[model samples]
Target chain A: MTWTVIGTYATAICLLIGSAFVMVGTIGLVKLKDSMTRLHAPTKVGTVGVGAVLAASIIHNFTFGYGSYHEVLIMAFLFVTAPVSANFIAKVNIHERECDTPPKPTVDEHWATLKPNGIEKMPDQPAQPSNGG
Target chain B: MIDLFNLPVGDGPGATFLAWSVAISFAVVVISQILAMVRVAVGPGSGDRILALDTMVVNAIALIVLLGISQGTSIYFEASLIIAMLGFVSTVALARFILRGDIIE
Candidate 1:
């Protein structure tokens, strides 16, 4: 009976904390200005919010003899993919000129300043038109 | 006797507290989903909408996990796993489309 009580408190507290994190992430999404700023919120969802809940799941499962580490797999997958997806989104934003002007460099042209030519060459390289046709 | 798999529902505050906490988690997940939708609808740029869409996916996964807990079943785990994979792929695809105007090279 005592162990059950401890487990319950642990799980409940974990769930409450997890839900709070999720709330913060979503509120940030709705309230933040600028596309760049908005990108940070979902990342929080991927990290703190989802992670806390999964911890609760792990704890809850222990009480039921469902001692499985499947949650670890889910966590690993999310951690790996969240960054990749965020990177892609940032890249798209840069390509689309959706972000604000970046800080200027004194010696060289900043990558953000370059206008990415569609269906063309590398991002940091100059556009080279073919003379073969 | 330990069932080694039975839920710990002794004459304690375990079950009741878990139930209430899960309910609260559900409410939070729903509110997050709504906020994500608002961002999607009013987002100024394609990138913002893409971010919002990804947030929604993560929020949905959390909800699925909560559902699994309330029902005391582990089956819902599979669905959340799949969603995680699909969410990443779709977000990348959409962002690629926006960046290059084409998905394939």
Candidate 2:
């Protein structure tokens, strides 16, 4: 009985927390001004929002149903892929000129995404020796 | 209200609290989904739209997990997982298409 009470309350708390984070992240996505700045918002949904809800599901399952760890697979997948997708989106923003251009690299003339033409040659290839070795 | 789902309101006040909290979270998640849809509709750039869509996908996963909890079932887990995978793949594909004008190259 005591365990049931602990589990139920914990699950409820997790659900509420997850819902709050999801709300905040969506609000950020809608309200933020710039494209690059807006990119910063929805990541919370990918991380804490869905994460907390999945945690709630795991707790609820253990307490009230047959326990299973499959939800962890979903959680792990989300954690692993969130940053990759975010990076891709940022790259799209840069390529499309939707966001501010990043500062010039000290060594390179252009950011790789902003390079003219389609990857024609490697940047700054060392000169081959005129004399054959 | 707690009796709506007919969930097992275990022999304590916590059970009722749990049921109510789940209901509230369901409503909250739905609201967030709508907000994300709004972003998708009016976003100034394609990047914002893609980001909004990604947020919507994550929100959908949250909604599915809540449904599983409220209904006391684990079956929705697979549905949410598949959605998560599809969401990531679609987001990356869309971004890649915009970046290179080709998804496979």
Candidate 3:
């Protein structure tokens, strides 16, 4: 009984948080002034909203004894693929002349999106630790 | 929990809460879906429209998951899985075509 209650609360909270992220992403999708900025919205959905719902599903299934973990496959696939699609879409935006003047390159590698190579480039930021691999 | 809320026809403890939460989230997702459609119809550029469409696909997946939970069914899970695959492939193909004028290369 106690575990059931705990699961209920957990599921509710996860659903709330997940839905909130989805809402925010939707708002960002439509409201952001730039195409690049709009990309940020679904990226949030990709990470937070989807992850939360998957967590909720996992909890609900486990608590109700329906056999959990199938949600993980969807979650993992989304996590792997969202960034990929985001990258391709960003490339599309850049290729179609959607973004503004290319920002100055921070390192030896220039912004790959700006080049015709079309191999894709991760935006350089001071915060990200480059190349975990 | 249903009695605590003083509502009739409760399924179980926290049933009302879970249902209400799902209901509210459903509304939120619906709002987003509408917003995405508006963007699609009023796109300033094809790129923007494509992005909007991409977002819509993802939002649909989220809605399907929520629906599965509310309806207490597992079939929606397969729908979401298929959407995930289709959405990714379509987005990649469209974007690739836009970039290089050809999808197969």
Residue pairs clashing in model 1 are none
Native interface contacts retained, candidate 2? 0.91
- For residues A1-133, what per-residue lDDT tens digits would candidate 1 score against the true structure? 5665777788889999999999999999999987788888777789888998998888778875575878888888999988889899888777667786566668655564244544333334446554331
- Candidate 1, which segments miss by more than 4 Å at Cα? A103-133, B1-11
Candidate ranking under DockQ, highest first, comes to: 2, 1, 3
TM-score (chain A only) for the predictions, listed in order: 0.76, 0.83, 0.74
Per-residue lDDT of candidate 3, residues B34-86 (tens digit): 99899899878777887888888888888888877776556788899999899
Cα error, candidate 1, residue B34 (Å) = 0.8
For TM-score, the strongest prediction is 2
lDDT of candidate 2 vs native? Answer: 0.87
- Please give the range of 10 consecutive residues that has the lowest summed lDDT in model 1 chain A: A113-122
Clashing pairs in model 3?
Answer: none
TM-score of chain B of each: 0.87, 0.94, 0.84
lDDT of 2 by residue, A1-133 (tens): 5878889999999999998999888899999888888889888888899999999999999999898889899989999999999898888789778877889789967787876444554456546233321
TM-score (all chains, Cα) for each model? 0.84, 0.90, 0.81
Question: Model 2 Cα displacement at B102 (Å)?
Answer: 0.8
